[model samples]
Target chain A: DQQVKQNSPSLSVQEGRISILNCDYTNSMFDYFLWYKKYPAEGPTFLISISSIKDKNEDGRFTVFLNKSAKHLSLHIVPSQPGDSAVYFCAASTPGYALNFGKGTSLLVTP
Target chain B: DTAVSQTPKYLVTQMGNDKSIKCEQNLGHDTMYWYKQDSKKFLKIMFSYNNKELIINETVPNRFSPKSPDKAHLNLHINSLELGDSAVYFCASSQDPSGRVGDTQYFGPGTRLTVL
Candidate 1:
């Protein structure tokens, strides 16, 4: 079973626009949520993360909002650039270091 | 320097062959993990080691074994590989394994294995 799910397979946004990616989870034991960005031939790099205690976390142009009640989380990228276009994966971890990942959402930022 | 690195970026072998993939991390992290990404791009955790101690072992076959010589190195060995074993394997590292709540995992470039 897929504990974490990214309903959208792909997303597109214009340059300098806002890009929002959503994720949902069925496991309530997962307290840590993270977002990773991946290129075509490279490994995924850490983007941002949020804990269950906080509702939102921001890093420069990237912001992650977590809704514990809805078991949902979203990543918002403001002023999205072409370089930001890549596959984004949402991951969750229970009480350990092992992570469960979603299917990933490919983002295309057009200029 | 690469925080997490895996050798032999690509591997191709016959169905009954045995192969080993090496992984190393220079970040001084105490936790290392192996993940498999199938053709459909679904990532699944295979095994995890913390400080050279086995911590998590997913529902993987006995043909697959993970060895960690130290906290900085974790290797995966597959015996008598099958066609279904063809996939991209990623090695990752983290600072701790006790669910620090905000620890980030660094992943390697991944090794693609093809079994005929």
Candidate 2:
């Protein structure tokens, strides 16, 4: 069973627009939520993360919002650029456990 | 500097063959892990080691073994590989699992293994 799920398989956004990706989890024990970006031929790299205590976390043009009650989280990229076009994975980590990754959402930012 | 590097980026072998994939990290971290990405693009952790000691082993088969000769090195060995063994394997490292900022794991380019 997949503890984490990304309902959207792909997303398309125009350049200089805002892009929002959604993720949901069934496990409430997961306290750490993280986002990773991956290119065509490269492994995923860390993007942004949020703790269960906080509702939102931001890094530059990227922001992550979490709703503990709903067991959902989202990654937002404001003013999306062409380079931001890639697969985005939402992962969760429980204490002393490995990260559980979603199926990933491919984002296409057209110029 | 390449934080994490894996050898034999691409491997193609027969179903009954045995093969090993090597990984090295220069990030000077104490924790390392191996993950397998299947055809469905699901990345799952197989093993984890900290300072040359095995810490976690998921529900993988006994044919698969992980070795950590040192803190910076982790290797995976598959014996009598099966067709289902074909997948992309990634090696990653982190500072510690103390939930610190540096605990963010860095992944390698990945090694694609095709077992026919």
Candidate 3:
């Protein structure tokens, strides 16, 4: 079964605007959540991560918010750049376990 | 320099043919993993090796085998290929598999495997 889910298959946003991508999970054991960005023909690169202990974590324009009670998480990109256009994957993992990934959401940033 | 690298970025083979995909990491990490992204684009873990020891083996077919020759290299071999095996395979490495707060995994460019 798919424990992690990204309901949105694609998103389009204007440059310099805020981009929000959401994710949900059914497993409560997952304590770590991560977001990865992949360009065409390239591997997914780690964008940001948040532990269940905290509700939010930020790095530059990327921020990840986690709500353990709701079993949901969202990635926010401020002033989204055209270079940020790619497929973003939401992943979750528990201690000593491999990551469970979502199907991914393709985000397109337009000028 | 690439932290994680996989050989033969693209592989096309016929059914029943055997093939191998090699992975190497220069990040000095002890944990390596193989992940397959199917047509649905769901990235699933196939196998994991920690210090050259098998730790996590998912419900993959027996035809798929993972071998770790050392801490820096992990190779995947398929005995019999099938059309269903067509997917993008990725190799990743982390400091450890304990899933610590800061234990981030780095991924390779990935290999596109196509079976006819």
- Compare the candidates by lDDT and give the number of the best one: 3
Report the lDDT tens digits of candidate 3 across residue range B1-116.
99999998999999999999999999999899999999999999999999999999999999999999999999999988999999999999998684455668889999999999
* lDDT by residue (tens digit), candidate 1, A23-105: 99999999999999999878889999898999999999999999999999999999999999999999998776588999899
Identify the candidate with maximal DockQ.
Answer: 3
DockQ-best of 1 and 2? 1
Per-residue lDDT tens digits for candidate 1, residues B1-116, read 88899988999999999999999999989899999999888888999999999999989999999999889999999999999999999999888663354558889999999999
The best-first sequence of candidates by TM-score reads 3, 2, 1
Q: Please give each candidate's TM-score.
A: 0.97, 0.98, 0.98
lDDT of each: 0.92, 0.92, 0.94
Q: Which regions of candidate 3 deviate over 4 angstroms?
A: none
Task: Give the runs in model 2 whose Cα sits over 4 Å from its true position.
Answer: none
- The residue pairs in collision within model 2 are none
In model 3 chain B, which range of ten residues has the least summed lDDT? B96-105
- The per-residue C-alpha lDDT of model 1 at residue A65 equals 100
**Tens-digit per-residue lDDT, B1-116, candidate 2:** 89999988999999999999999999999999999999999888899998999888988999999988999999999999999999999999998752345589899989999998
DockQ of each: 0.69, 0.64, 0.74
- How well docked is model 2, in DockQ terms? 0.64
Worst 10 residues of 1 chain A by lDDT: A91-100
Q: For each of the candidates, what fraction of the native contacts does it recover?
A: 0.74, 0.51, 0.72
